[model samples]
Target: MRDRKIYILLTDTGTVLTRMIRLYTKKNYNHASLSLDSNLEEVYSFGRKRPRNPFIGGFVKEDITNGLLHNAECVIYSCTISQKQYEEIQAFLNEIESHEHSYRYNLLGLFAFMLKKEIRRKNAYFCSEFVATALTKGEIVQLRKPPSFVAPHDFEEVGDFQLEYRGKLASFYHNKNHSYQLSLSS
Candidate 1:
């Protein structure tokens, strides 16, 4: 039997949350694929001009919902939405649910949904282009460099060691002999 797939629609704001979910869940899922009409940047730009109107935001949510419904067996929305905004989404979903041909829908609030059990229940889908283009180039560059460790000149006699950072404290110790320990505390 084929495993059921759960589609997750993620906003840029919820990228971190999504990554955490994927890491903890170890399930495969698809991310919402957006076209011009459903692009988040366009929605935010348009919403900025009509700050008092909820229609644009509602429409954006609906677009995401519709996009996920196209292929997913179930859907999970992972975005940082305020209570008021969440209420708006729930109302909108209810309206959509009343339609004759709407897919089964589920709303998983970003923070609340991060729980391990909840995350493990579904697979995650991510947009390759979005991830590749959205990630800061600098962060990628940083990742390529070998991590460095430094100690006072007095400890130069000690061989190389692994470095660790702990809030305001930087330390290095030899794991083999446990004969060397160097620490700098701010």
Candidate 2:
């Protein structure tokens, strides 16, 4: 048996960046992240480099709460993956993190998406794009659409994932002592 876990975090960050994405996407959650850990304390995504600026973004280690997303609302989805698959995910993410500075946010790709088009770049990614890529690279999910075309809501459509929690991002921590029926392996 494999001792590996994966989580997808969908958040309505309520930031200017999120609001802008929501305005165009018309979706409840405008940001997406993937975490190797169940607690979602260590999540990865491409997002705003500066808290106040929506334009400049890049690969990032996301926080489910505190800082920019402290007051955000979120839904967490959990999935169990095989050891080999999990290793692939870790390797892919490790590569990205190892040369993170070489990556940037794909603004043109995002704009193309708004127009129902796709414009992929070698070293750039957006929120959902990165998450989709991670899942595909890990072989945890097979996407019908390309990673660049994925939206935050798209993760919700993956039947393999189970909804673990849905509430304010901070509330989960406060209610952690209670039985929430979610677990992750270290």
Candidate 3:
């Protein structure tokens, strides 16, 4: 069986919410998004549904090349997964995307995490929680704690993901005219 790659993007968007999160997590990148492709065409996360409003957030297909993530500093990591795992992830994302309106950002869950508690909402997730849950549901990785308890830094501890790129999100764009390769592995 062949293997496929999935990208995990950890970013610091410098938003008020992210800044607040940083005060607690003390992590450089406070947000996490999962990308199905290296080019980041299929990035999914639970974040600001609108660039101007962080409160009205939910299952969002982020545009890393524009809006909040464009100027953000990020770390990209890639993990190898079996074809079956890829399909499982795709199916899970597709199901949620199909009912995206029902989903909402798990703001309460995010707060509960600070106190070492988990809040299992019906259809909601914070950024890292969403990514962690998706990866777990795909059978790509098993986390020591629940997804709600997972933070951006925990991804590194739990998975065999290789560091791929580290720089401004704008520089990471893959286009015809330009490309950036600040490979940490090299």
Candidate 4:
């Protein structure tokens, strides 16, 4: 059977909230998302439900073509997983999406992480925490620490992920399409 790939997207959107997070973490990317496809057509994250309002947040199916990710800087990493693991991930995400209203962004958990504490809220999660939990639930990666403690940078350090791309989030699609066109013409 062929192995399937999942993507980890680390982004720095340079929003006011992201700027505040940068002050604390001093990291290049302050947000993370998981994508089921290399084209990033199926991306998920715990972030603002509305681009203009950062207050209302939950599990979101991200649209990279607009909003915060439109011009964001990002790094994409791909991890190979068995078909069984891929199916597990799909089922997990589907379950969450089906009851999306029950989930909320873990604001308190984020603060707990800053305080070096683990707060696993029943159905809430911050971006990286959610991504880590998803991968763990899929049986693809084992976490040395609690999912609540996982950060965007930590995925790079822990997983056997391959660096897929680095540059603007918008440009990823542009470049991918450009490269495909180049190959097609050759």
Candidate 5:
């Protein structure tokens, strides 16, 4: 019997990577086993101990890609690394891709797509139009209107801020001298 081939999807964000892995396992690997690791702890420790430099960080990402490529059939990278680090991973993959013993693998970045307005609004702030459209149509609508210019540090207006996505709805609250208000909801 042929040995069951395993595909590994690697990423810094364990949650998203695990979700992808679960989806893949359900679709392709009913009998095959899977594993998930965040590697965030190690990354945090290394970042704290090592000098803050791109070359060292690039080497770390390269090492991870190289090690995983040795045994896995394919690798899906889903990290928020810079382009230089990404290039280093690609270079390592190119070196391994030539080997006949190796399985086909790919390195992917999580933030490959530009931050579209819809995703930004969904994640950053709650817009009524977004909520109504998403609720009514069951689909996302891109913010077609041009965004007004606002200073990055406009705390009073809350131009845009990052918020965690808990589920279908996201909420953000701001507190002032005398009153508190919810600014964003989706």
Candidate 6:
């Protein structure tokens, strides 16, 4: 834990598309983001580049105050991993972020999940798939299902990750305290 940290940021997003997804899945959240830090300054996910439009998604560096995530309701979980794992995750993220143009949102995978099917597309991922892949690659979690089949709500089922924060993204992002050790309950 000296050299690395990993976090899962699950957001309801409060966008029309996410709201529509919530209605369909009857779940608490519809979007997922992964971060190597607690402040979430480096959050990454596959989602709309522009919040207003549900379309046009790819590898994105996410922020709480930006476009879709502004004031979004979210739950954040923190996990500790070894230095070796951290380096591996960092390398993967570096590659992905540097070549972000090579990736796209997996709309077909999302549809397949809704239909209780599995579809894997190279260089394509949805929000949860991306995060799940990162966590899996980091050896933080052994995902029994394909990353594409993983949903935002699924992360909550695991007991290992610590629920560090829950509430509006703005609350944690803009907290005057500037600490990640907030209360477990909002």
Checking candidate 6 for backbone clashes, the offending pairs are none
Candidates in order have lDDT scores of 0.24, 0.85, 0.88, 0.88, 0.22, 0.84
Candidate 2 runs further than 4 Å off: 177-186
User: Candidates' TM-scores?
Assistant: 0.19, 0.92, 0.94, 0.94, 0.18, 0.93
In the range 1-186, model 6's lDDT, one tens digit per residue, is 475668888998777788889988899888998888767778888998776667888988886776668688989888778998898888888988888899999988898999989888989899999888888888878988888889999998877788988888877767824664545766
How many clashes would you count in candidate 2? 0
| TM accuracy, model 5 | 0.18
Backbone clashes under 3 angstroms, per model: 5, 0, 0, 0, 0, 0
Could you tell me the lDDT of residue 159 within candidate 3?
Answer: 48
User: Judged by lDDT relative to the true structure, which candidate is superior, 3 or 4?
Assistant: 4
How well does candidate 4 match the true structure in TM-score terms? 0.94
| Model 6 vs. true fold: TM | 0.93
Error of 6 at 57 (Å): 0.6
Tens-digit per-residue lDDT, 56-138, candidate 1: 22112323222322223221222232344334434433443354133211222222333322221121111322221111121
Q: Candidate 3, which segments miss by more than 4 Å at Cα?
A: 174-186
lDDT at position 60, candidate 3 = 94
Which residue pairs overlap in candidate 5's backbone?
Answer: none
lDDT of 4 by residue, 70-142 (tens): 7999888889899999999999999999999999999999999999988889999999999999999999898
> Global lDDT for candidate 2?
0.85
Ten contiguous residues minimizing lDDT sum, candidate 3: 174-183
| CA deviation > 4 Å runs, candidate 1 | 1-15, 30-59, 62-110, 116-186
Query: What does the lDDT read for residue 59 in candidate 2?
Result: 94
